[model samples]
Target: MRSRGCAEFSIPCPVDLRKYLSESEKCGICNLTSNYICRFSMKKNEPFEETLGKTAAQMSSQKENRNCLKGPLVLDFLFAVLPYSAAKKLFDKKFSIPVVSFTNLGVLDWRRLDFGNGKINDAYLATAVKHPPSFQVSVSTFGGRCALCSSLYATEKNRRVAERFLDGMIQELESAVSPSSHKAPAKSQNNAGGGSSAQRQPAGQQEGSDSKGERADARDKGKSKSKPKRKKTVHQK
Candidate 1:
């Protein structure tokens, strides 16, 4: 059983979503591809949202289940169809919305998800810049604990602000859930978000690190299991 008052306690969650697009142009829409969003919200939370909010979430998942992508794709099409001025107007209007986009990824038994190797312990969803909002809040539950990870893609000043905001939210959540167990760790920043090279390291760094580490670990295991060679003494006649 989990400790009584430590249910809400959690290690600090860190994410750096600011990725300057220098050569994303390979995809044609690279310049405009900055607007990235993740499926952070869960299916059950759909009912808690307001009118348009709930409808968008439900429709997207429902269409996805039906082998259709039209529901969410329409939003992209709308942006594409709008004139430059109209698009800018829309952006300006949305800029007034909350600086952070919050959503939950539902509960996942990540402990059961394995890649023929070690199982996954925890996971978080982070996305790149999309329009005015520079931050996105993602919630996920694993091993019976809820984790909130937020990503930020903005200028240095804005990045600090967003980071502090996330830290505050984490504290608030912990406090609300279990006041006695409220002990927040200091936050650390690693360019590596979610341990993905695409997110943290350079193109090849992630693979390189993982491969080297795995090889080293395997060598250690092999050494530990191998029996020491016995030396046979030859009798001199």
Candidate 2:
């Protein structure tokens, strides 16, 4: 949202309380989730860490106050005393849907989803389709790797924008985990020594060379019969 020029926005995050329930209170197949909306503002060129800390603090406060449980309690009281139509109307008038949302579905279990045939290489959870001007991003993990999926109502222009947004998000996450100092030397070496430097480069020393000659020496000594394999799967909304 900040990247799209929206300085302020609110996102509703679902809070599941099933794990907090007593064993006797654990009813089967029921919706035990509520949510709290967190409003945030992004200053120009703000550091990601500052934003992350603020978000964490807000969520912690909400959790400490048991805000998630209050939503359900309020709804139950409203529907209990008021007529169905009156309650519905009141709820609609009081709450407005947000334009942006995010959800994390946590890790997926491959064994449970298995069909007993081909292996489940990778999987990601996708959010429900949202109308124009509304967008949602969901994440899921499988095989120790995280996957992101997005959903939105799109025009040709909106589709292109969504693609670019997701791409930028991926790059941002990558940069957060892998620092620039770790990435720069490999790119510099590749540029300096031409195509031959790439094939003979070792995984650990890819970003370690100070000069072209050192890079050439590392490349020559680091040759292996088989290169490490990397698997990447991309899912577009």
Candidate 3:
């Protein structure tokens, strides 16, 4: 209840909207305490909210629903790597765009429309991580002509960029390959076993040290288990 004295003509009356407490009762004491006590116990207060706010919560919910729609949306578009010649062949096969002389077309950089086609705002050949192990130049399209990159390699730069881009991608993936660096744990895993590699570590080492040590200890643990089985058989014999 609001902390105000209950003596206002405009005060809402629960008895009925049309009824009012008598003017004579303004000074006369009735059961203000009981009335307030009953109201507090019976009535549920409305939850408090900021006076002014624009909710991003509703907008976020709407965005999530829209994301569920089929195919990639404009906002969800991603760069894909494909061979330059293959990409050109695809465009040539699908669309009627010509893949003739390189000089007639303006070489695309960041600013210029990528291909002469009005659909593509820009085109470039660059190294990317999308293709791993081997470097191969692939055409990239943005804005509109991105759809046509598969059919034609229009500019000299496009071909070179594609080649360079593939080179870089291969280099990046290869760099991640350190000799003897097995990506998976060497130990055999069980179908129902819940234990992770971390859990296999001996108790004394810190987690950081345990990670490297676990691999080294794998063979030792196997030998230890086999030793226990052999010892039991020897005792029985």
Best by lDDT: 2
lDDT of each: 0.39, 0.57, 0.25
**Residue-level lDDT for 125 in candidate 1:** 45
TM-score of each: 0.37, 0.67, 0.17
lDDT of candidate 1 over 48-110, digit per residue (tens): 223235335644654344222332355467678998788768767653433445555566654
Ordered from best to worst TM-score, the candidate numbers read: 2, 1, 3
Comparison by TM-score, 2 against 3, better one: 2
How do all the candidates rank in terms of lDDT, highest first? 2, 1, 3
Identify the runs in model 3 with alpha carbons over 4 angstroms from their true place: 1-152, 179-237
Residue 108 lDDT in candidate 3: 37
Candidate 2 backbone collisions, by pair: none
Q: Which stretches in model 2 have alpha-carbon errors above 4 Å? A: 1-9, 20-32, 181-237
The Cα error of candidate 2 at residue 230, in Å, is: 12
Off by over 4 Å in 1: 1-99, 128-133, 181-237
Error of 2 at 58 (Å): 2.6
Candidate 1: minimum summed lDDT over ten consecutive residues — where? Answer: 228-237
